[model samples]
Each structure stands twice: as structure tokens, then as C-alpha cells.
Target: MTLKDFLKPDKQANLEVFSVSPRLIPVNKSINFNLYINSSAREGVDRFVCIWKAGKAIQENDVSEIAKKFGHIYIAENQRNHFFKDLGDNKNLATKEKVEILKNAALDHLDQLFHNTDDMIQSESIKKCLVECEAAAIGLMESIRNYDLFGLHDLIAELDFHDHYTLDHSINTGLYNMMLFREINPNATNEQLKIAGLSGMFHDIGKIKLPNSIINATQDLEPEEYIKIKQHPIWGRDLLQQEGIKFQRNHLNIIKNVVYEHHENYDGSGYPNGLKAEEINIFARMTSISDFFDAITTKRSYHTPLEPLDALGVIENTCGIKVDPYLFERFKRKILKDEKLDSALYLPKDFDPCCPHTALDLMYEDEIQKSELNENDQEDVIHYHWAKKTQLPKIS
Candidate 1:
């Protein structure tokens, strides 16, 4: 059964509910459970929480308290620790074990990405974080591409914008890297795909040097503020050189170009260095297309995210001027050729579905309703008339 089926409410429910274990059941169907905790003062709950314990029943409220204290809240039936342990330790089940490791790793990485904040970094710390993030992104890509790993869709669905621009950009870039990688070579080796994925994750690592105010700006800034933003590419190149990533000049050039030239224009009107057309690195050119696509499609602090088709239209409008003509053509062809890939570009209603996006959807719906109401108001006014001879009823 699917995850949606698993979350279905149980019938024959009891008010005096106790925890049930699904491991005891045979492999007949997928098991699902949801935790409910009472936090009302009259109900006398010190804390509202629930959790799963392997091979044991929750006897005391203290157990619940312990779970809550340790932050053991939601537990998935299929995500039991034993599953990971069994998958990790078994040699005969190498492929299955690898898939499990990769999936869990991806989920764990994403969890850190979504939940963690206030740990922003710039120099050495930023370097470490980028390395780990790249490792995870590349590893996940190789796992999914090679083994067709399970649980990826669910994991990807859980991605949200809680970790700020760095986190969101990392995940988005990694995802897009996988997309482009698959488009170019679905059967690529693990190493081949891994490097490409790493490139995606670290594409913007250089932007760490930018002033926080500019990076997190909510509205359009003055001309001077905009000029400072353009200096980020030079800052990025210097950062990479200091980090000693050790690659061919071409690869470094491409990556740095992406960092530097992502905002560059096709008609020779970008920033930092505005080398036109053939002068732009191919990787950066590819990134320019993907980065803008995600930027426009992703919900930002100041702008509503566009739908995929609308986003595509934006890309089309900028073609030959703002974006690489050849890359745009390639992107369009890929979208047209693959329905699934095209769908991936569009945000799914149930996926992520973060607070910001949920709020946007609600606001959009309300606006539509108000517009309809206004139209109806006009109709009512047009259809109504007051007669001077009308008589009023008297009440005694």
C-alpha cells in the first residue's frame, strides 16, 4: 500500500487508545499510524508527544515524557532503526543496503537542511558545510541514478524553505543537477554523476562572501546596493582558489563562471564579466538556465512563485537576450520530449507545501473569491431598482 493509504484513519477506534506495534504483523500490507497527544490544561497533559519504541509497550506516561524530552515525535512504520541496521550490516543484500543508506542519508541531509538555522557560516565553516552538502547531494544522485533508490520522492517531498537561501539553493541546485545529468546520460557511472552533482551543490559556495543584507534583501535595492552584488563573482573565485578544490582550469572556470556569470545576460549585458555568447562557460550557461528557472518557480520573500508553464514562458521571453539561445533550445526540447521531467519542473501541491507556499495559495484563492464577489456586487447593483411608491410594513 502507498503512504497515503497508510495514513488513512482507522475504524473501530477507541477513546482509550493504546500504542500498537506493526512489526508483529506479517508482510500482508503496509502499516500506518499517527500519534495524537493531548495538551489541554483540563486534560492534564504535561507535554503533548508520542513515539515508537522497538519491541516494547509504552507503560507509563513517564515513557511518553522521556520520548518528548528527547524530541522523539513522529515515527514512520517503515523507517524503524532496525531496517537501516539490517540494510547496513548485511553483505548479501548489498544493493538493497546501499539503497537504504542512500535514502536515509538523503533524508537526514534534507532534515538538517530544513530544520537547522542560526548556524550560518562564511569561511572555514562554510567550506566544511559545503563539502558535506556536496558529498550528500552527489551520493544521493549516484544512488538514485544507479539503483533507482526507493523513498526519494517522499524525501524530496519533505524539502522546505526553512533553512534560508543557502539551504534552499543547495537542494535546488543538486536536484537540477540530477535532472541535467539524467538528461545528458542516464546511464552515467557513479563517479561521473557524483562530480556533476557536487558541482551543483557547490555552485554558489562563493556567494558566502556577499554581505548578508544583500543576500537576504526583501526588496529591490538602490543602484549602489546592486553594484555591490555584482562583486560576488570575484569573491567566489578567490574563495575557491583558497579552498584548494584542485580541478582542471576548465572545470574551475566553468564553476566559477556559473557563480560569476549566473546573472550575466545573453546580449552582453551581465555583471562582473559580460563575455557574450561563445565566451560563457557551457556549465555556467547550463546553470544560468536552471538557476533562473528555479528562482522564478521558487517562492521568494518578495515575489510569488510562477507556475511551471508561466515560468517556461518567462524563459522563452528572455531567450536570445538574457539566456543562452542553444541551452534554452535544448531545455525546451527536453521538456517537450519528457512529460515526467516537465512535471518535475512544476511544484507539486502536496510536496514541500511549506508555510510560505501554503500562505501564497490561500492569499491567491482569497483574491480570486474577492474578485468574483466584486463582479457579483456589480451585477446586483445593475439589476436592482428603488421605487418611490413602495409601501413600508408597519409593526404594532
Candidate 2:
């Protein structure tokens, strides 16, 4: 189903909002709602609880004990003293406070992860990072509902993965994917936005399992190595299941489809599952286009990335074979308007091509000569330059 269809509020849908504590429940039973200690204001509902296929309310015997476990009322103002500045007048109190609280919580969580040891991945930090990411995903959707596209875009810049470019790439893709969603449907509700954001952020998390050498490799991968690389989606899917994050069919399906088919081709030439055309999950199709576009446009080891417009050309050339034609058409005209596309293609005047960190590590004469050619004497900068057609190397 399209995003709009998925988010249509079911007033008739019987979802119970318990006035008591929500605790761990088996996945086979009632859906456990994990209340955010901070920021929960939807129609004055501070706690979000969802279970697949709503069932009867809990018995009175369980209510009193649940209430005892979650004693005392939690207020947003109380949560803010530890996080932000003044409340700034009380207008739109619920929505505004929710934004502040969730954003701060997300930031705080990310900060803890960032400061953790290099072995942070092995610790609970990665899972906490994912939790924070989930919260930010929800908060971001609410932000989109109440703000402009540009304001939402700025919030994305704040969610930077400065520690690892790969992590940054995942979050940015999720953010951009949500941005595109907003652009397509200005009236998109919070839940749909949340799912899209979460799916986007965790799309390539399987790469965490691959060897750092393969992930950080600057050269072309060998055939066997490439095969090993392709196994990440399954690895990631299994890893996520092992973590015991209760995900419904829709959420799990979207996540799995994105992880597995984001590399698939519309012309039936893609990997893992070679289903083509309308057979591809709509969400996966959308993400695949975004993933490929961003991968080619963003800087990577094997190649100096193309500008966005050049990337657009590549998309145009590959559509029907590499991308869904209809989706590409909308993406080009609706999302990347001609003027904005031109602006996106513009490189900063002082942009550098060579990564000094990588260049400085070179030990060979040829490597030093190559680095010297890329270096700017006046600015001491190593700028990336476009190579001529004859200089292009073929992938083996």
C-alpha cells in the first residue's frame, strides 16, 4: 500500500490507552508500548502503545499492579530542566515540548554512543543508538507535520553521523527519504514518516558485520569478495531478529525488502531476488532509487563521486533498466526541480578532491606523485578532478 493508505487514522480501531504502567509482554501476546519518559503528546496522549490486531483490554487484577510499577505522573517540564533552555511561552505546549524533549533525548543518546570506546559496536551502545534513532524517527515525522521542508532539512543536518561516514550515510538516506516523502505528500502523518525514517536509517546496518578491510577498501572488490559483500542483507536481517525488537509484519517486511532489494534492478537484472517491474515492493523500489542515486553522488573510495545533476543523468540513462521509470520521473520533476538540481550540482568553490588523510598514508613513489598532482600549492589543498574518458578504468 502507498504511504497514505497506511497512515489513515482508524477511529473505529479499538486501541486501549492504559492509565497505568506498561511493562514487558510476550511478543505472541499484547503489544508492549514503551513510553518515552519525555515527549509524548498526541491528543494529550503521552504514551504510545501498539499491538498487532487489537484485543480486549487488560483485566482489573493487572491494572493496579501496573499502576504501582509506573508510579507518579511524569511531566514534560520536569524532563526539560535536565536538557534544554526555557520553555519559551506555552503556545502549542504539547507539540513544541514533544519536539524539544525527543530531540534532546535523541541527541543525548547519540552523544553517549559517540563518546563510547571504539568497541562501541560490541557494547549496548549500538542498540541504544538504534533506539535513539527510532525516537528521532518519530520526532522527525512530527517535525515534518508541523514545519516547512527547509526546516525539516536543517534538522537532518543536525543528525550527522560525524563519527563514521557510513553511519552518516544511513541516517542521511533515511532523512532524505523522509524529505522526499514529505515533498510527495505534504499531508503525510507522523506514523508513516516514522516507519520510513526508521527503515532508511537501519538499511545497511549489516555492514557492521563485514570486515573493516572490505568496508574500508579503496580498491575494486574481487568477485568472491563482492559475493561476500552481497550477503550483508541476510546477515543484518538475522541480526535484527536476534536483538528481539518486536516488529510487525509491515515493519519487518519493509525493513527486509529494503535491505534485500535495495540493490535490485527494475528490468529484472538486480540481485538476491530478481523480480522486476511491479513485483518489487513499492517502498523498496523507492528506497533503491534513492540508495543508488546517493551512492553514486556521494563520495566513495573507488571513485570520485559525480555531482547530483550528473547523477541525475545517470538515473535518466538507467531508468526502465536500473530504476522504475515512473518513480524516476517523479523524483526528477517533483523532488529535484531543474533549478535546484543545477544548484545541487554546483561544487563549493574551495572544494578539495584528495582526502589528505588517505593521501598522507601513501608510501610509494607513484602514490606520492599522484597525490602531488592533486595538491594545490597555494591552498595546500588536494582537490578531486574529473578524469577524461580515456582515463576511465573498467570494472573486472
Candidate 3:
């Protein structure tokens, strides 16, 4: 008999037979939803199987006789669908709202996978997290494909502030890489974008293996400590290599290259193998630009955070030395354009005419000359110098 031959019409056919409860599904390998089928009708069981099959929802064909008898289908819920529905009014959400929803979902998934876990650096835990990371990356690319560059800029800026620097940094890197990837290759496919996002998110996974003291140290790291920290790329690459068994060959290659080569500089000055220019994978080069931008702009225990433009300026100076010059130019333009839009929308209408403090302000001669200025007075001097330099033109 054919698969459709099992259907038997009944009164319960019109009733709710197949249902999944607790709609929100966590990103994990475990079963997240309860599938129920009315025991009163055999048609309900057959109907459920047919619908699921038509949707191509179920990957495995083999089924237990007991489950088939009761019309129960056990399966992992689609993480992307669960995320979209949980954001509310998924059917009519605006593009911007969709982007926000996807961003939050990615962040939440990473937080659960990394923050709550014990010893995130463990090989088993890293492997599990990488699987979820790929899912989040795919979702991010889907949302980004429908979102404009301006909307993405706003979304990244809005979500940029987070207590967990590692997670936030990873998300931003992935996002920025996606944006840059689209610009570089306008015809890029969804799979390519997914690979780009995944590379950015997992680029720093090796850092988890480092000691907390080194990772979170407030003071300048000693040369010995710095040397230890430098091993993260090696650690990250090896970890991914071991975990690559589960991923397809293409995906494994992308993940491994990104983790291993992101730190390598354009001028052969970076760590690990110190590959130069085109020697490094293009995705790794893209990730490096995003990684450096996010790292300098975000607050850390060791140093004060630079403003976005100032951070860009720092990156600008190192173009061709630390990052790919051609790609950096594209990235710089994209960021500057977004910064202008952000300032227009968010800055107060009656904003002060004075310039804001920047990384350069710290080295202003006037501020440096102050002998015994109080902390407040010192700030005043820095701001005064900055305002006088140029009447705060919108960063172009």
C-alpha cells in the first residue's frame, strides 16, 4: 500500500489532532516540543505524517510502530521558525523589526550556549555550541538579506551594548562581515553569507580555552601572559579541526580558515603563521576588519573604549598593515554613512556645539600640560581642545 493509503476519514479529522505545545524551542539537539495526535482517529495520524512529509519537515524516514500507531511524530522544532514566532506578529513584522528579532535570537542563543555552561572551553561544549552557531548564522543571513544597510547599521548600534563582551563582539563581527560580504559580492548566495556569518561568530571560540585571569585582566598583560593569550588562534584552529568531523567539507574549510587566519595581518605582521595579503582567506580578512573594529569600540577592562569614528580612524591608520586596504576602504565608507544616519536620528535636536571626547583628545597638548588639574577640570580641557579643532562636522 502507498503511504497515502493509511488515511481514514473521521469526525475528529476537523478537530485539532496534531499539535506542538510550548511553542518556543531552544537551540539544542534535544526535543523541544511535544507533538500530540488525537487517539480517537487513525486519519489524524496519517494526516499529520502527510502534512509533515509535504513540508519536508521530517528528515528521518524510519519511524517506530508505536509512534505511527498513535500518530505522534517526534522531531526537533525549526529554530528559525520558533525565533520568528516568539518575536510576536511574525506575519506582519516590518523589515527593521525582523532584523531586531533575528539579532536578539542570535544573542539569546549564544548567551544560553556559552554563558550558562560550565567550562565553555571544553571540547564537547565547544562542539555543541558550534552547531548552534551555524544555525544562528543562517538565521542572521536570512534576516540581513531582506534588510537594507541603513537598518542593519541601526540594529547593530542598538544592540552593541551588552555586559558579555565576548558574545556581543562575536555577534557584531558576524553582522559586519555579512554587510561587507554583500558589498564585495552583490550576487553572493545565502550559503556564502551563512559561511561568512559563522566564520565571524566562531573566530574567537579558541579564546575560551584561555584562563579567565588573562582574558579579563585589567592591568597590562605581562609579556609571558600576552604570549599565552596569543595561542588562542592555534587553540581555536585545532578545536575547530577536531569538531570539523560533523560539518560538510566546505563548511569545515571555511570555519577552520576563519578561526586560524583572522589574526593574520595583511602585511605579514599578525600572529600564528602571519600570512600576508591574499594568502589569508577572504572571509578571514573580512572577519579581521570587523573583529578589530568591534574590539576597539567596545569597553574592556584593559582600556577605555574609543568612539566609533575614532576607532575607525585607528583602523584607518593600520590599513594595509593590519587589515586589507581595499576592503577596509569599503568598510570605512559603510560605517561612516551609518554613523551620519545614527547621529541624525538619535542625537538631541539642541545638542551642544562642542566636539565629543575621542581617542585623540587624550593626547591633546593642552590637556597634557595641565599640572594639577582636578579630574573634572582635566575633562574640560580635553573637550575644549577637541571642540576647537574642527566644529564637529558629521563624520564623512
By lDDT, who's the top model here? 3
lDDT of 1 by residue, 112-168 (tens): 433434444334543444444444554455345432112332334345444466546
Which prediction has the highest TM-score against the true structure?
A: 3
Error of 1 at 319 (Å): 1.8
Question: How should the candidates be ordered by lDDT, best one leading?
Answer: 3, 2, 1
Q: Rate the local accuracy (lDDT) of all candidates.
A: 0.47, 0.49, 0.57
Q: Write the per-residue lDDT of candidate 2 for residues 195-264, one digit (tens) a residue.
A: 6776777677666666666666665566686777777767666656555455455766687677766666
Across 1-396, the per-residue lDDT of candidate 3 in tens digits comes to 333443342322333232322222222122223233344355325332222222222222223332456445422333333333332323334545555555565667666645543643455555556666666666567556644444555567665355666767788788778877887677888678878887888787677666666665655567787777678788878877763356667887888899888888776768789798889998998998778766656555545666666656555545556667777666556546544311111111111101111222233233344622677556534433332232211222
Q: Tell me the spans in candidate 3 whose CA falls farther than 4 Å from its real position.
A: 1-75, 78-91, 94-125, 146-153, 160-162, 299-304, 333-396
Pairs that clash in candidate 2: 40-46, 353-383, 353-384
List candidate 1 stretches off by more than 4 Å: 1-127, 143-158, 185-192, 243-254, 338-396
- Output the TM-score of candidate 3: 0.62
TM-score of each: 0.52, 0.53, 0.62
- Backbone clashes per model, in order? 0, 3, 0
**Residue pair clashes in candidate 3:** none
